[model samples]
Target: MRSSMTIVHAPQSDIKMIPSPILTQVESFQHWKNDIIRDIARYRAWLRDNVIYDQRVDKELQLIQARLRDKTLSIAFVGEFSRGKSELINALLFPQSEQRLLPSTLGRTTMCPTELIYEQCSEPYLKLLPIETRQEALPLKHLKQQEDRWLHIPLDINDSKELQNTLSHIGDTKKITVEEAELLGFDCQFLESSSDAHVYVPTWRHALINIDHPLLRQGIRILDTPGLNALGCEPDLTFNLLPDCQAIVFLLNVDSGVTATDMQIWRDHIGQLQDRSATNLFAILNKIDLLWDDFADDEEIKQSVKKMKTLTAQQLNLEESAIFTLSAKQGLHARIKGDEDLLKKSNIAQFETLMFESLIDKKEQSLRKNAIEKTIFLLGNTKATLQAQLKQLEADNRSVIAMLNQGHGEMKSIAQQAKRDQVVYQNQIIALKASKQAIAKQVNTLLLSVNQDHFSTYLETTRTNFKESWSSIGIRESIAHFFTCLESDFTHLEIETNTTIKIVWSIYDKVLANSKLTHNANDDNHPDNTDSNIDKNIDRNIDRNIDRNIGNTIDSNIDNDINNNWDSHSSEQEHDLDLVQPTEFRIFEFNHSLAGLKTKATQYQKSFRSLLSGQRKSTHHFFNSVAAEAQQIHQAAHVEAKAWADGLLIPLIQHATSRKLLLDQKVKVFKALAETNKSQRQKQQELVQFQASIQLQFEDINLMIQSVSQKRPQQSFYESLKLKSTPISSEPQVY
Candidate 1:
């Protein structure tokens, strides 16, 4: 793939340098997002100039802009303690430093799950959440918003030693009694005993590291997790946080192979993440340098490493291509000393290239669908408006030409024909009003299906069931029953929305058909057989002319894309010819979030103790978080349904009403021409001039729609795997 960085060799290095593949792709992705934002802004300006912008469209576009600006590409590193997760993070992000940025000591350096991120407003610091907060009933997300609950430590970015010393505070521990550990939400059976009565536990529950690093400033976030014991105790880490990340890198120790504890961590935490299709999973056999020996040749060592990869993949039930053997220590050493040969042998570069290929494409596709799809719908609205106006102008010019050939008595007959056309427009407007009421009644039923009261009742029933039985079987049954009823509600909402759309579109089709009949009658009465027809022959094929010129306007001036970007599976986009793309109302895609919770619920059921107090704490921890998330999802779905109903029904009625007013204005102009002594030449010239202006405006609208709807081109994967001696400078701030 093409990168934004260039190679620069050191003084003593034998070969030229290569940049980091992941960083290169990240730079390219940031540029691609900026292009999408710019296109949306231009589309909004076009709407305002065309007199079609409204309050609803303005609010929706603002939300989309906010989502693109705040976007972050997050990755999580998960494994048990002593698996080299911390070491791998240090090697990947801080290769140029003289020492490891994060302390990777002999054992359990990262005692809690720590996140590394960059915020422009904040100075360099470490924020720690105390372990005592585990006794509360609030979820982690709510706790994070309260600044007073965390302890903060400041750091100097220029001093590497000071930063390293401050980061080692994450591994600090406290000695507490076994009874005290249980009271603080830790299972006493899993703690390491310092004495007969006391055991060791982590002093903090979570850590947040904010610093000005090159990759972190580009919106690259990293999460370093603790061991199996911590994962079993925290439902927020497994359910709310880990499942939301875009990619996960799970590491294993090569010398120990896949032990029983390693299998427990995989089955309980990392493996369940595969249910979320958006998350990418990969396994690393770290600390491979321990297998190297001087007695064996290079070919023999290669065979041994290949054998380990095959066995590890089979044991984890993953493909061999997803597993790699690498020594984090060797990779860090090679990058610091500018040794290209040692870095190639370490195999870290190969792993990074594959990660870049898998992540960048998926992130780009997701941003396009979320941010650009709505812009395309708005563009379709503008296209339909312009095309309708062009058709009306053509019909009006035909009437003026026929009036020039008539006597005084024939002019009187022509005025009566205009009166008949007004009646046809009036009947169609009445039909649209009746359809509006029918759609409003159906929309209310769809909203009621997803109301908060229904979801609240379901939550209450699940809580009661757990309180009565307090058993593991009760927990499993309650969670399964809760999601089943919620799924039924969504199914009902989908069925109701489709039925409403079909009925409304049928009414709109009848109105269009009636309007066409009125235009054809006007054409038959006003046949332009005089020499004036020859003057208008140059502009006869107005529609085809606009299409040809629009291709050039979009390619040279706008986003250089012309094909339709709306979903092909949408029934409205398929059947409607007027480019009304919003007829197909989409509910939220909540399936991935629901499936991730179900997997975590199953794990929670298995890990609970038999005691009544322990069961109470576990139930409180799991259900409180689930209830809060469900409320937000249900409320959002209701609001979106309301917006879609208004968007689909209101604009259609307004369009029909405005067309009737246009017909009235044309009748008045014809009556004035029949009575007054105005010159026939002056009237004909005015009609012809108005028709030309309508044609130009129609072409401009078509070009603007194409500029916003085109999909962006993707870059090819990079074949070479290598890194520079030093990291490149950070990218410009996107927001």
Candidate 2:
């Protein structure tokens, strides 16, 4: 086996063993990780400043950024108990240690899931979580929040024996009763089914071996699990932690080959998903020294290893080239003693070369693919959202311009109607003012009358006085009825607007319909004359339909927009309360600093005078509101009617000649807004160019998808992730 492995080795003239690819890749990955972090940070800042926010989207970006910053590539070492799993990790990381850094021997079975990590400028330590936490059904991660539950033992860095003694405790276990096991959330029925008097349980759920190792310092995180039963009991490891791992080193004893348990572990855990390639899903045939049959020749050992490799590959459904057979014990011994020939004989050189050559390269590509996708997705979404809003704003601008252009002949028609409207509205307003004046005079007359003013004063005197003063109190009742009548003004105005709109339409239809007919008596021939009549007829019909359909459209708009989606009656009730309740019929009581009834009565008269003055002022406000509201309703109706009517108006009579300056001013306002939007337009252009560049980036990192199917196009990048884009279809996309 040694000779066969050594024959495949590269010439070692320049091979230095200490700074391996494990460290090399870590450095490469750090750069890649930093670049991704910078990309995400830039994106995060842009999103914050732009106020682009979504709960899911922002959170996803935040998580990716955090993962990039963490930069720890977790390599899970999986195998059955005592399969030299820890030994391989020690050989890979701490090759020069004279003593065993991790618990690895022929008979030792690790009791807990251990995490071997490195911390800069810190002494070595072993942190253990209690076995009692199993009952909480909580992961070690959650229990980590409470520091009191953990036992943290500091290790003396210079004392290797002391460190080994403390680390050896990771394989220690305690015997507990069936009742105690039940308390730990273990099913008592299953334990009782077994014949054991007391169940042996791990003293710790997880262990953290913090050491100052070179590879560990380079952000290498090693997960050393007690492979078989530990994996079965731990749900978090099976689902969350293990799935995110960059690599899983499945170790097997070379003498035993692929055991039934090893195949089960691969099938159920390691080989469950092909998401990570076989290169990352590694299977190590360790303890190859056990395969050394000193009695047999080199050919026999080579044939045995070849058969084992082929069978392991078939069972794990992995490429044979991805698997490696090595003597971890021999390699560790060589590293400790500086024995180069012994290290080469261990068959670890090829594994080291593979690690140094491809581990980081593959990891970098995988990391880049994930990072680029996330960045592109988030940035694409932001660009899409901004683009969508911008497009709508632009569309609105165009619509307004088109509508304004539709009103080219409107103001002339309004100017023509102004004279007629002035005469009619002036008469109606005059009558309204006169009616209001009479009500004021009546109220003024009532204020000065002492008999009416003293009604509230006597009302508190006796029940008999109240009955007698009820007639005077009828003044308050009349005031209440007046407000009710005032609310009818809104209804009256709506009716007035309806009538005015009808009259305008009637006038427009009559004139435009009749104008061309009155042109000539014998104008049946001459192509121009015939064309003129046809044009006039088309104009009349178009304007009439525009008027007819627009009313329905406005009615539809009001129905859709006016409802605030709360209590349908809340708005009406609020409006009714404002117009009525406070001012409505209440007996006037004079509050003063006098004691006598006569003094109060005199004060009551003064109060009544102020009340009358306030009511007159209120009446002025009331009339003004009603008058202004009526004018607005009519103006709105005219706008709706004119929008249609003006479209077909004879330019000679209905052109907006009087309002050219006003129209020009409106143009300038719109032009200013359009000018301000230029920056957003520039951003939009840049975003599109950015999209193309990112699209090319998508093409570069799209290997994972290509691994499945080659026919996929770059356009399907977002489609695969189920993202959408509102593309400006007018612009063609280049491949």
Candidate 3:
């Protein structure tokens, strides 16, 4: 039976606050982040006085802003037992702490996974869950709420080793006689049926360490996962925790290379990156110091490492650039001692530089990109509105200047031209109106094809097919088959969307052709009465993919790990005498499998729906865009035609009237019209100035972004770690 645990809100009294390395330097990443925050603020201001947006646009902008406010980077490090996973973490983030943050030994010490975190301004502490809770199979998120279920251990940050000592228990496990293990819920059915057999069980199922390290203090939380066994037992680790991590590093031993066990981990965990970004996943060839050849010089060492990197890349079916090699032990030692030569030998500094360049820098780029895209889009709309406002001002201003100078004789000709222009505009409006009606009819027809019922029917068809194959094919085959179903449904949505886009453009072209501006009936000198109109504006579908491949790039980085989770504790435990008890293991396995099956259908439904939702949003957004494109052209034409007629005729009429009127009446009316035009010109000038200033800011932001993006590895760090030898084959050299 499990016992109740006590919980206390971690107090912030007397905590050692480490200043972040990032804050100490004004790096490119920090600079970009600050710029983005300022841009977002300016964006909000612009939106306030200018553009009107809907709920969806508002929600998206808010989310990007929230990411700015809460700048946390979470990374997960996963590997099998004895891969020096702990040492690599210690090397990367904990070298300055001067004490080992977690336990690492030649033996399998890290029994369960641990998440190292530091809530800003909170005192350092530890939360441990006892092994007894494994029976309940409750997720850690729920168990965390009970507070009492955890063993809270507060730390004395003043003592350097205090944290190290407390965290040593992460590696702690207890061995029990087979019979005793069976009594405590381990399965011992096939363990030689021996009374003397012993089984090892982790004393704690999970540990949460709250420590104030420099990186952690700066909003970076690292998840140090356990060996393959814990990944088997912990469902929450595979599902809830790992999926949320911004980046995941898979560590492998250089001596063993991609072993059978490593391959399994790759196929299950790392392979899931097909749905997520391949960029977010990294494979490290660790313990490279073990491969140092006695006779090998600098060149030879380079060749060997390069070959190994290439081979590793081939085995994993990843890009060679994605595979990096380093010796964690040497790296930690070098970092602690500040030995540059040893650091080169360890290849740690190069890896660190690349991480700073690739991961951390890319993270900043991603945030800025989100801000820039939305800002750019909204600003584009604001600029168009300002231009529209200005066009009206320009038309009115020109009319006043012309009216003041027009001769009485010219009035008759100008009036006759205005009348003819009005007729021409009327004809164009009729054509435009007819075109708009056709578009509305087509849009309605297209929208009918995308109703909720239609989508639901497609999903139901997929689910029905999934249900039929699920029992016969088992998990792997069933999953592959389900993706096929999704592909089919996705294709249906894509095809329908593509057809709609074609129909919309076809209607646009046909209607816009009907708008034949008659220059002969009106003023032939009108600026818009030329081939430029048709060539420029009528090509409505230029470069715009209506559904944009129906989010082809969107589906490339999917989150498909929801249901395809494979437990890592192999059935190799079935006969191993030195591991988990067999009889109880069988029961645990059955229970976990049964539980997984119950949730499988639900998880699959959620996953497919999420993918479908992305494509659906793309379709709708595309629909709106096409509609807006067509509308803008019609609106621009209407406004221009009116402005031309009003601009040309109003001034001539005013001049004719001024001649007839007495000086007093003419002066008052002339003054009022002149003041209105002057006021509008001032505002229009301000809008132009504002646009220029914002454009400069936008240019600076883009230049800075590109500088970081094009940031090539300088010869110093990159050359030190460059791989000289290439693998034998271009193809995946299966090991």
Return whichever of 2 and 3 wins on TM-score. 3
Candidate 1 wrong stretches, greater than 4 Å: 1-18, 95-99, 187-189, 293-295, 387-436, 510-578, 581-583, 607-614, 650-715, 718-735
What's the lDDT for all of these models?
Answer: 0.65, 0.48, 0.49
lDDT of 2 by residue, 245-276 (tens): 67777889877878887876666455643443
Clashes in each model (backbone N, CA, C under 3 Å)? 2, 1, 15
Q: What digit string (tens of lDDT, one per residue) describes model 3 on residues 512-566?
A: 2332334242344444633344223323222122222223212332222111111
User: What is model 3's C-alpha RMSD?
Assistant: 18.5
Q: Where in model 2 is the C-alpha error above 4 Å?
A: 1-17, 36-65, 95-99, 119-123, 178-199, 227-232, 267-279, 293-295, 352-366, 374-735
lDDT of 1: 0.65
Candidate 3 regions with alpha-carbon error over 4 angstroms:
1-27, 49-60, 130-149, 175-195, 233-236, 291-302, 361-371, 407-671, 674-735
TM-scores for every candidate against the unseen true structure? 0.77, 0.47, 0.57
Name the TM-score of candidate 3: 0.57
Highest lDDT against the true fold, candidate: 1
